[model samples]
Target chain A: MNYTLHEQEFTQQVADLIQQTACILPEDIERALVSARALEASDNVAYSVLDTILKNVDVARKQQQPLCQDTGLPVFYVHYPCGISTRIITRCIQDAVVQATADGFLRPNAVNPLTNKNSGNNLGIMIPCFHFMEWDKPEIQVACMLKGGGSENMSIQYSLPDAKLSAGRDLNGVAVCVIDAVIKAQGNGCAPGIIGVGIGGDRVTGMQSAKKQLFRLLEDENEYPELDKLEKSLLAQLNKLEIGPMGLGGKTTVLGVKIGMVHRIPASYFVSVAYMCWACRREVMSYKL
Target chain B: MNKKIEMKTKHIQLPMNKINTRKLKLGDKVLISGIIVTSRDMAHRWMMEEKSDIIRPYLKDGAIYHCGPIMVRDGEKWICRAAGPTTSIREERYQSNIIQEYGIRCVIGKGGMGKRTAQALRTFSAVYLSAVGGAAVIYANSVQSVKAVYQLDAFGVPEAMWVLQVKDFPAIVTMDANGNSLHEDIEKKSIQNANQNQ
Candidate 1:
């Protein structure tokens, strides 16, 4: 009646996944950081900070500990196979998060927005946020991202035909807006950052699609040729901004750029940029159903 | 606040007085050694509201780190597991007031704050230091002792007041009392660079 793994076992696996996602920095992110460091000037403070970051990454791994104190809110983008209960999966994920928090693998980061209270167990209203998508494959694929607050606060959305920046209703307009977002953020989004851009959706989905890009591998190319070109161009342009690592002023401001698109109403053109810190913590795990 | 202490290069000897902090320029690399109190949004609010005479003694002449660290209890004692600077801009509205209220000499955080806080630093004879964002693991190693903590039930763990004794804690003087700000300079220059790149 259930998937290949028992429900309890499935829950345990998800907990381990959260723990791994929290503690381990992905290889692609590590590579990008090292390359960014290489690009910085010898005298720049960005170089020294990057050196310390690399060392910090090493220590977190050797100790098998969380990379940052603010381990971040766990976001699960689930590609569930047919016949699985959504309620069951959600409950199991919440249980896993609580387990991780108790074990010290995750900080108690979740808080009640209205009351300013935290459950101390990483469980609150819609905490361990999930994005579910049905898939043809029998096995379940769960891609988890730890969205930290600092960069999340910097996530932005802009309407097309904006007059202030001379932005219009085209891809060029999107480029200007995206670059503008990066520029305003300066070192505040915890640069150097990975920008996940969403174009052509309503305000909500526009932001959602942008966050979805964070789930992609850092080095992976976009599926669409045009989006790919945009990613390449933006990545090149953002670095030239020279915001550098920790905003200390250097040659590297962005490690990667990912963009996703969706159909939108004729009247609206929304572009959302989701700024992700260089820690860029995420992991995708699969199990047979 | 002077004993004519020997200076350690790359480290800011703490319990920082005006003389020592004023000496630090923008982008000066230093590791801090001394007691620093940790407080975030609500703690800042409470400090302003309560302004308790009891705590002012501890806060004066000490650093306020804009961080919400992960701490676990080891029996009666607490241990800092992972402590890194949170974005200081969120506290921008309240930081200046807190600084002026208490004779706070230094502020340690990341992603440098705004104009009001910068002006306040100049007015009050203080400086803003930046700890490396995402440098939690190493920052944790720098926390030599957890002297005390307060207000857990009301504010929660991340929002609690953690009084920490740190040694060789790493940070940079991103905002100096001399009215210089690295973030502002970078923002200005980056806008110019963006125009040129286009």
Candidate 2:
């Protein structure tokens, strides 16, 4: 089988994606910000904080600077066609990250956990982490997520039966767990955030689901009506906590709530919540080359 | 009513008022019209290792900041290159000792330190202030002047001590010397509230 590699085309697409990630604040995130401001209490300190954050985003975008100082660790999820070579796809991503860092489009945030020595190129061990999902189609789809440490530190996984008994199971149970985590997180995770909930899977799978759901647009109406309703309910419940922006007393604690679920064993269901800060940076690119 | 207390370090004397940790909420920006210094892991370590008088001039009634900032030199003057706050958790090992040894009145950084530091805060009538994390540029604007850089040539930008003169720098009172800590209180209350509601 003869395989054609269009290096220029691939390079251009990845570069454009990186630029888009750097310059543009996703529409869903923008809407969430507006929603947070509107839902915030009038006398709340978070109101001003949220306003400052929104203003910062504007300044960063206008100035072509990073939305947040922590450009974050680049994580890539690739859906490759069965015929495509995994090695080639991985190499392409590595190349893209190198080019992006050199161009100053992305900051190099990868560092050794123990030694604290930075890779300086964002290409350290297990970095630009790739997770492959095989698809039957002929084209590859790459979703890139720049996961910041602030919110990423707040990710949690609960064993269903145990958490359910402790916190009470059901949608409200999930909401309470999430809100509790965020509040306990205080300003550490950076607030005016989004929460991604993954229900009904094993531990690791649930975590992955929650993380993957973060890539979805905040305004994306859920395909499953029940999940859609639950998302809205969770968002409302979380906002009512008055954790507000940046954990100061206010109304809008969470910008949006997204729930993704799958079938699980009859005995147990796992739940995971992943938080993403206002500086959510992600992009998706579909390429033929 | 705001209760006022005087914090003295070396030569610097700071008159600060006791504010409720709950009320001293995050993002409630305030003009911190008090004495604060820029100190972090390396500076703290140097202070301990040498027991040096290098910090004596600045330790007077001043607060120490835990930061490893990026700096650049222009001719004779040094400027902050990317002076962002490092995680405070890293300094849990040295903060308490440094605070008591130096008679430091306050510590500033993003995220709060551990229990020992909190205990030191209570024992010494000191406080820990949480500066807005990731707002390095915003914090930089508040810096009025750079007084001096200690151990400059040997240590890199992040590790050196660059003494600064700042005015009305914004900070949230996270831990107070009176055995009160906003971070601790919030975590306890939040967890309790969560358990009850559950």
Candidate 3:
């Protein structure tokens, strides 16, 4: 017999998940911000900015208000055991999104590209994008991230072996491309940002993998030794850029760096960078079927 | 090159004059009081296309905020749940015109504006202030009242123009009337550092 999920109960859980995720700054992100704050001098502009950010996190959690007005595009990743209907799960998530929007946990972010009209309920085609996978586990696992538009605008992709950057198809070229993206993003990406780097995949997969890296905890080390070293080196080099918090200049430009790799076709060499702001609102939940 | 920028806090009243705006310098922290109007992407376009007369009175010598607040209704009154600045660069196309035409003395938002907007601030004797990017609740707490709203029905909540009365709303001057822009300075220095490292 296949395990089943109670429809209404599951929907309510997802709604609760949205509320919790939107209002609470994840512990890892909050800790990273606290550590970053200590790096700056007390009287510096960067210190004040970090101070306000820490206070904002506290106020949002205490008052049950959203961490950001943009609440962002709700992207969900779900994994379920075999025989559980993906259709039902998607519908439940969609319903929960509407309930959350009406409750003010999320803003009306979905809009029609051609008409320039907002759906006004955070629902549109491909709105609240979903990725589903079948796993061996008996329970369902879901993770959601509220990615704001400012940071989304800063995400970039690059083709290696480029003459302009003097970048080859090697890791050195990847480093150069990543630094270039950071320079171009400046404070625009809401600096003291977190960066997710994806290497050696085709364009779309590279970008997708890069975004997936953001779901990792700030303190988690890369499984691959080379990538771990690369992450550490990039973090140090980015802070050295002195873009600081909001690009006003300080010692800390980024709080964390996560990198992932995938195999690519020989014809193409794509490097994708996903820049996440300090807010970094993401959460994970597990449900027993 | 970690140069420490010392900041001093000042409380400012609305409908400010050129002298006050010009007097403010980069890196000064400010707590603003009185009325300010929220205008995002759609509102900016409407202001330029229709030349909104309804909001002009409130904006002249007043402030324009690049924000889209999340609002919830309690009985008959509207309560702002989360209110933080959005990126100001998206409004660059209409911002210079809006600043000049509306006599806007201050522009508030996050992720600083571009060279064109900075030039307008210099020419018009205004300032660009940046709030923390994700500090929505802190900003919403400063709201004394929801004074009025425009284009709510037509433009939807996020894109609507909300006139709010606030007290002690905090921000920092990143761009001043003297053509000094911390954003531009930081960008230039960072690029130089990147090139030299290469």
User: Which residue pairs in candidate 1 collide?
Assistant: A4-A289, B11-B31
Clashing pairs in 2: B9-B60, B9-B61, B10-B60, B11-B60, B12-B60, B12-B61, B37-B63
The per-candidate count of clashes, in order, stands at 2, 7, 0
Candidate 2 lDDT, A1-289, residue by residue in tens: 3346676677667767876676466877877777777765544445556665666566556655455545567888888766678888788878888877766566666666676565666788888889999876667788878766767877777765464346556765666667666765665666667888898788878888888888888878887898899888777666555555555546666778888987777876678889887667888888863
Report the poorest 10 consecutive residues by lDDT, candidate 2 chain A: A40-49
Clashing pairs in 3: none
Residue-level error in angstroms, candidate 3, position A137: 0.8
List, residue by residue over B6-105, the lDDT tens digit for candidate 1.
1323576666688877888887878888889888999999989998675676678889999888887888988887888898898988999999998898
CAPRI rating of model 2: incorrect
**Model 3 chain A worst lDDT window (10 residues):** A184-193
Task: State residue B81's C-alpha deviation in candidate 2, in Å.
Answer: 7.1
Greater-lDDT candidate between 2 and 3: 3
Ranked candidates (DockQ, high to low): 3, 1, 2
> Candidate 1: deviation at residue B25, Å?
1.1
As a whole number from 0 to 100, the lDDT of residue B68 in candidate 3 is: 94
- Per-residue lDDT tens digits of candidate 1, residues A146-264? 87788898899998889998999888999999999998888777888999999989999999999989878878989999889989999999989888888878888989899999998
C-alpha lDDT of candidate 3 relative to the true structure? 0.91
TM-score between model 3 and native: 0.97
